[model samples]
Target chain A: MSVAHWMQYLPIEIYVAWRYMRFNLKQSFIVALAVGIGVSIIIFIPSINLSFFGYFLEKTVESNAHIKVVRELDTEARNRQTLKTLYPDEGRILVSDQSLTRRRDIKAYKNLVSEIMRIDGITTAAPYVSESVIIVRGSQTRTSTMRGILPEAEKNISNIEENIQQGSLDTLSDDQVILGWRLADELGVNVGNRIQLLTNFGKKSLKVSALSNTGIYQQDLSTILVTLDTAQALLNMPNEVTGIGLKVRDMYQAENLARLIARTFDLKTTSWMEDNAVFLDQIRMFRVIIAFISFLIVFAAASSITSILIMVVASKSKDIGILKAMGTPPNAIMRMFLLQAIILSLIGVVAGIGGATFLIELYNATPYSKAETFLGIGRQPVTLNLEYTVYAIFYATLSSILASLIPAWQAGKLDPVEAINQ
Target chain B: MIQTDTILQTIALTKVYEGIQPVYAVRDLDLTIPQGSFMSIIGPSGSGKSTLMNMLGLLDRPSSGSLKYMGEPTETWEEKRRSQFRNEEIGFIFQAHLLLPEFTALENVLIPLQIGRNLSPARIEHAKSLLDRIGLGDRMHHRPPELSGGQNQRVAIARALVNTPSIVFADEPTGALDSTTSRSVYDLMREINREEKVTFVIVTHERELAGKTDRVITLLDGRLQSDEAPKESPS
Candidate 1:
């Protein structure tokens, strides 16, 4: 039916429904309170999930590269190995002998970096060399992953410069290194202290120029940063780099761009999402579970509303008969109850939204220091999302109206003569 | 205008309740009611007086046979149309007053007008006038629970007359009131019948109240035992 037709008798219906609700104040309050609790849960869970997800994404993207370009594997050597495995004697005779130590380095990376920098939406591209090394200070030694980076270009791709706790990264010379705060603590060294670095080629004494803490436990515990020249000299591999790190304007587009870059440059590319696939999947699953639980809570609240309306219909049957005897149509009777449901739901949703907002704000304001111990995060993560709140209210209202329908129809179908006689 | 003298007519109307054995509540009754007449229906507890009253008031459908209003057969009319006819032409008053306890006396009186459509200022004034005529002008603002039983019944009477219907069906309108209140209620109904030119069909067990109507209809065993005008003062 058109809204106009439905609204023809709405004023009177609303009047009667409002009077009934006012007359039964306690029951109406209970229904509204139940709906409010349901709404609060719906708003609270998703909003917290979104905030946590956003925080994780921000930390991951800040600490790591948006995209990484690595050297592709040698397929010719792989084919030779496959042939040797397929036919032992005959394949060994047919295959040419080749060295297994193919270089694990990107060639012409400087030119590639310049070329990739010209692409739209690509902010920066920086080449870096990674190697495992041991550090010694006063007989205390620790093993760590040492990264060799171009100071200026790496600053654009990673937030190490911003997270530097002491000294500076721009002044990093060939003989100086930046140690993670936790690594520095383990090695018993401080900024400006000299530490002996041992690699496969030779040993060198390097001075700690800076200490950085990115707030990631693993990175802080095992990372040591140095200049590209120092790392190449120490590893005895000059003019060779392992990979190129890339930053993009839009972080979400990293995967698609990584695929495009791999196809165009014949390099193996990995995006941030590919690097953290398992964690992202867990977050997605957690979101689905929270949404399901929220829906159930809302459904239970709707059941309470249904029970309340059914009681009203049963208790008001005599009034219904009197109204019918006074010539009220069945549809009008139905609309009257429906209007009551709508009013109750509206009150509930408003109250629920208000309560949820208050609770979220209170949670954010409280200073809980052991958040990392309790929730695996250092600080409170809660972002207010208007859209989720609106959706929660909408669902609560729609479900309440649907729940009220059966009782409303039953009241409408009541036999006036029997009702009055009863 | 083609006006029929009869307001309601029923021919061999029957109502049977089906169970282990069928119980006939109203059986093969032929009756006619004229315009602007005051009448009463009287019977013992199980004499089918209520069943017949319900049928004539359009609150219940007969098991078989034809019923008509103003010579137009009503058996073929839809429930919606029947409700509309009741709203525009018939009123009802039950034994227990049946006023909505949540509403004031004035609002109770305005129920029929409100249900029929939106109540205009003129209709509200008319409802107020009816309350005043029923000697409940000061009690109009009081809810049913706040008013005495007699006052609540007076409000129901005012509500019954508010729509200016052609006929009013009152089933034991004074059955719950005291003797003095019941006598005053009967006198009020008689005065309304004379002044408003409205037909009133009442069902009651009190012989004294039944004898006061212009015409009295007596029923027994689901059948009419007597239909006659009492040879006494019409008041």
Candidate 2:
């Protein structure tokens, strides 16, 4: 129902407070305006910072696997751990050795993939074989990393589908390949054309079925996609495939889960979080700084409330006089002023939420540079969050009550005889 | 101790304002007010008439000696007890600033009962009847600023009687009105006094109005000078 109709059911002190504010709308609006500006600042600054951070992080983690399982790092890591135990000396490690570079495959790879899939937080585990090869498009050859994949599992673990600009991954086969758009542009090859793949063991002719632009500089220029069976035959490892790539529920949990996977499955795991530690640390520091600034703004708003309520108490002393003479207790008088503070803050919370939502909508509608996008996606979702908005409301209200306490007490203690004369 | 027939009594009630030199506002004042009596107190300026009225109405405490309400001693009552007494047992009216400016006349009349949080439909009906009796039934919804001075004073009177209190202390109840309004306000109080059997103790400088009550009290320099019938001379 309407506000006036709802007001009739309130207790007497609250009713009196509403009437007092209605009698002095100009003053109440000014105080509410101060609080509203503070609240909007709290919401708007965090939203923008987190939105940009969120977009950048998505781009960093979505273009590649959260965790990559490999064989080379696995044996090296195991030897290092064994040396640490044998030496047991804090100052140095002994018996460390390096092996000649040889292409090694995870044995019983299909069985390992199934085992990795069953682990918690692992959404999917795709076994992929990547080999360095040269593409010969009319004898203009360039080296590229050719990735072989079970198309369905690779699709689940990566943003390859979203990055596809022309043609489709559905057409990819043993003889079909996906080339990065920039690489195709450099080679003067388009979809429906053929490129010769020169691997160590043999040569194969592949049709270009799709082109993608993933917004990652190296990936977009030096990567090609083929079927898993095609790469195994070319590498002459028909019974073996390369390491697995993982998709996880939480990107931040990738590091810890990687440690657990290395210990559980006796394999090495690498997380993207370890690769971009400096950037992530900087974002975390920015978060702390922003939270501190928001607190100061809310504290300033509370100070404004204290001053405003003090002035109101001084102005309304005459009303206090008659109320006391009519047998109203000092506590009731105090409650009247405190209730006004609550109502004022409630108005500010609403106005702040409304103002922040409106401004964020306008910001989201503005176009940003395509280079800053994740997976070349168009819009970033940067708006007021429900959780922090609730916190803002609670803090604003509590501070207002605390700020108005002394003034309300003064109003209550006023002598009826003196107040009336004033 | 107080007599059962008396509504209020004071034994040597005194008030002193302490400073570099003490100034006595009231001293050694013993007074007894009988139930359902219409009386008026008259004195020159600085004669403690207002001070005594304040003590009797529980708005101020006496510095020495005890006051009794309905035979109960009130010397040690806390503010909560005094406020309770003021809300339930007594009423007060002043010359101006009597009603809250924000509330309508009807709501203003409901203040005493509402302050105690004991308002019922019967109390509301009583308030409406009080206003109607004082010729303010039509203006019940109008605020004090919207009404004339006399009309507002009548509303104050309705407010003072809304709780059906045994005694109402009126300090210059008609002090701000003209002679015609003063007469009408005074006449309405006497009518309610006869009909409801409520006691009224009026403080006024107008001897002509003071002469119309059943009893007239005269004070001089914080001392009671005489107690006599309304026929006695204050002129």
Candidate 3:
């Protein structure tokens, strides 16, 4: 038969199925509730996880460079020397004399930066020098890592300018430095206060020009920023850079782009994701576990639907017999029950999505402090993703259809004579 | 044109139940039912009247021999073909009325047409007219559970006639009704048979009801005892 002709038969099946469900409202409600709970969990857990991870990812990516290109250390000589010491009589090591020479800086970093910027998806590139230094203010002394950067170039890659709490990065001169808010507090110094900075070369007195707080405890505790020229002059290294920081338009592509840059430039590169792989893996694991648990709940809900359908089929055997005697085809009988399942599942899925959405909105509307404590974040962390809701409904419908198949088949296969007799 | 009057014929039809000890539910029954005929098969308990009805109604296959409808042998037909034939050409009414309680009286009458996929508005109106003619016009909206036993039986009768089948097999259709209700139901069936020229085969244990039909066939111990018209003497 043509599909249109088959479609013509569906209304009667649907009507009968709807009538049956309406007749047994209590059982239908119970089955729908079970499916609703299952669908709610399916929607809730994933959406919250996405929100939590999305929030943290935004913070982490904004606070740091998306990709970092560093000078590759000459480790071959050291590794070979250790191997020789460990296995002296094993063999002769085919080590090249060139391995002993260490390349401590990237040559033509300006050109390299321009070349990297030409690559698709790379937004900005900035070169900087990073080293450990000691800060002295009166009798107080603290060791901190200092980064030397061109203020204008640094603005493109990092959010330091926006994070500056006092003074301004644009006004920084060669004789001035920026300190983290907590670092300046530990030194008992404010902006415009002269503080002595000690490097491997010698001590230089520089004025603290700005203080910044990036809302991260570790960064605010011990970090100082200075101009690249002054840092090069202090370390007696001219026309050289220690590393280059890059920002990419697509943060998720950072890892692959970092690997590409490493292969292209023969330099060591690390993306933010690689630096925090363990935490990302943990989040992924949690998502998978949540999905599995949600699947189990849906399966349980499907079982409940199955049992209810079986009971209805068993109780309605006489009706089935009469229908058969009336010449209702076997397929129509099956379709009637399947239609009931689809309708019940649709109701449950809609209710579940609505309930989950309301709960999400309620969670987000609560006080920040309470929500922060509950979600372990600085703000609410539950985003309502319509895609997950669609997925939940789709799976619920599929499970419900599958659950009703056996019972519906049995009903379709019933012997009319025996059923009528019973 | 002269059309054959034999609507159904059975030749030495037998049905055997195989169990711990095999029992013959029907044995060596040869019968013919003419078009537009109103007949009753009557028998005592265990006389296989119900089994014979089931075989004749296409609800069960005979164990041996041939059963034909309109001169076409039915034993070789597929289940789908048989069901289609049954839907288009046959109707059945059981003792319990067997109306789907979920459906109203009108919907119950339309059940056969609905299954046949011919439920146009005209057919629906015809169903309503059938109910109206059966004295159920005002109660067309009531479900079977809400209707009296006799009213439900009338609905069943309307349902049986909805498809306008060639033959309707009613198995003790008024068994659950009172004597007065039973007489009324029989009168309705006789009126439909005469007006529509539709054949009807009724199965009953009540001899009085059997005596009312044009022809009566009696079964005893799975065998035909007699087939004749009722005597005029009032026993």
Candidate 4:
């Protein structure tokens, strides 16, 4: 049929459906309400899951580099006889073919980065130096993991500058450190304020250069960023970086790239997804359990609709008989009854979606407080998503269609002879 | 021209119900009804009058018979074909009036036309005219339960004629009404028959009603006892 013709046919179908529903007002309302609530819950839960997943991703990315390079650390740094044996005599940093060494000291880090960049789909590689240091602003001092990087090269590997609030990466050259927003707030320091940094080897006073605010509250508040050269000098690890952070073209491709890099380097490399497998699995498992519970709601609503249809079939037996006697076909009679169920379900679904949208909007607008905070922190804002509306409508539509099938079949099977006799 | 005389014809029509012992509700009955005729089938409660009426109305299929309407064989007809035939050519009224209580009087009258015919303004006007003719013009918007028993039956008659069926089957149509109301309903049926020249086959247990018809067929134990023309006209 042409779309126009089908569109024209809709009103008659609706009228027929409306009349059928109007025949039993109470039954229709009950079924519609039950189905509506079922659809609302189904839609609301998925949205919350997606937001929570978003929160989890942000935190994982903040804690680690885009890709961490794993390699063996040198055991003995400074015994001249052992250094000659391990580092090689004829201008080589190391003699092992498994390691990529540079003829010159500067070329060693460059060689490592160049080798990593040669891998297909590897976007950028940069050296990252890290060490645990005490950040002291007067008498108020806190233990923190200080990470240092080459600002320009690190841009490709991390979102350090993007996360900084009060200062830029250029501030690192003036013996300055970028602190997480929470850590800076706790220290009561502003941009250009001086703070003393103490490592195991020595102590140096650095200016508070930036307040970094990433949504990952713990990492945002606790970690500090400094220059890789300065970190190496202060921590007494000269001409050495702790690890190299590498970037891939896609975040999702991290695990695959990590595995390939691990094989090439002959070292253990863990991807972000692998590191946070338990958390993601918990979210997935929770979604499955909640979705199953939502299915029960749909089932209850569908059962109620079925019961209404059954009752309508029973109560309207005489009318059905009259129609049959007037030569109404079994299929037509079935369609009339089935149309009633579809009508009820459609109304319920539409109302549910509308109601759920309103409620979700209200929830998103209103601030929600958690009784116990996440990560030993206080409650934060609730996030609502549009995708939940789509999910709810989709599930409701499927459930309604499924609910009408048995009733339609039963109506079709009614014997006109027996029905009229009753 | 196609012959109009044999509007209805049956050859050895039989309907048997299966049970511990099978019951023969209608047995080997051969009957024919001509166009523009008024006929009544009369019998006691179990004499198979209703079963015969149901078969004639196409509401129930006979177990073994050659039932034909307008010269077309009905034994092998599919559901849609049967429905089309019934929709355009057969009308039925039952004992309980069976007016859908939710619909107004006019809507009830328009049900068959709306279901079967390609409805236009004229068809709707015709329904209104039928309602007005049945003295329900002012009550056209009232629901069946809101109206009296007699008024509800009148709505049923209006619905029956809405499609302009060639024949109407009435199975104890006046069974629920008082005698006075029954007479009035029968009067309306007779008036419509005379005016429209439509055939009517009324199934009733009342002998007085059977006596008033142009002809009567009597059944006893699923067997035809008599088929006689009325000796006198209705008073």
Model 1 misplacement above 4 A: A1-10, A73-103, A118-120, A134-143, A185-188, A195-205, A215-217, A232-240, A369-377, B1-3, B233-235
Candidate 2, residues A1-422, lDDT tens digits: the string is 12123443456678789888888898789778877888887788778877777777787688679999976446555666666676677245543233322345777788888888888899988888987888999969999888888888888888788877778776678998899989999999999999999988999999998998877777789879998988888888785777788988998899999998888888777898987888789888987886788779888988888998899899888788778877778898999989988899889889998888987888888877756645454467786866668777888888888888988999989888778766
Where does the lowest 10-residue lDDT sum fall in candidate 1 chain A? A1-10
Greater DockQ among 1 and 4 belongs to 1
Instruction: Indicate whether candidate 2 or candidate 3 has the larger lDDT.
Output: 3
Segments in model 2 whose C-alpha atoms lie over 4 Å from true places: A1-10, A44-63, A71-74, A77-105, A130-146, A165-177, A187-209, A229-242, A249-256, A271-290, A364-375, A381-384, B1-3, B18-23, B42-47, B205-235
Global lDDT of each model? 0.85, 0.83, 0.85, 0.77
lDDT tens digits, residue span A1-422, model 1: 12123323446677799889999999899889998999888888777877777777777786679999977555435656676776587545354444443455776677888888888888988899898898889878888888999999899888778878778889999999999899898878899899988998997899999998877788889879899989888888887788899999999899999998888887788999999898789888987887798789988998998999999999999999888878888898999988888888889989998888888898899887644542224665586667778888789889988989999999999999898988
Q: How large is the i-RMS for each model, in angstroms?
A: 3.8, 2.7, 3.4, 4.0
Model 2, TM vs. native: 0.84
Which wins on lDDT, candidate 3 or candidate 4?
3
Q: Per-prediction RMSD in angstroms? A: 4.3, 4.6, 4.1, 6.4
DockQ leaderboard ranking: 3, 1, 2, 4
Query: What local lDDT does model 3 show for residue A122?
Result: 96
Note the DockQ of each predicted structure: 0.49, 0.44, 0.52, 0.40
Report the error of model 1 at residue B39, Å. Answer: 1.1
Best by DockQ: 3
Interface RMSD, candidate 1? 3.8
Per-residue error (Å), model 3, residue A370: 5.2
Which pairs, if any, clash in model 3?
A: none
| Weakest 10 consecutive residues of candidate 4 chain B by summed lDDT | B113-122
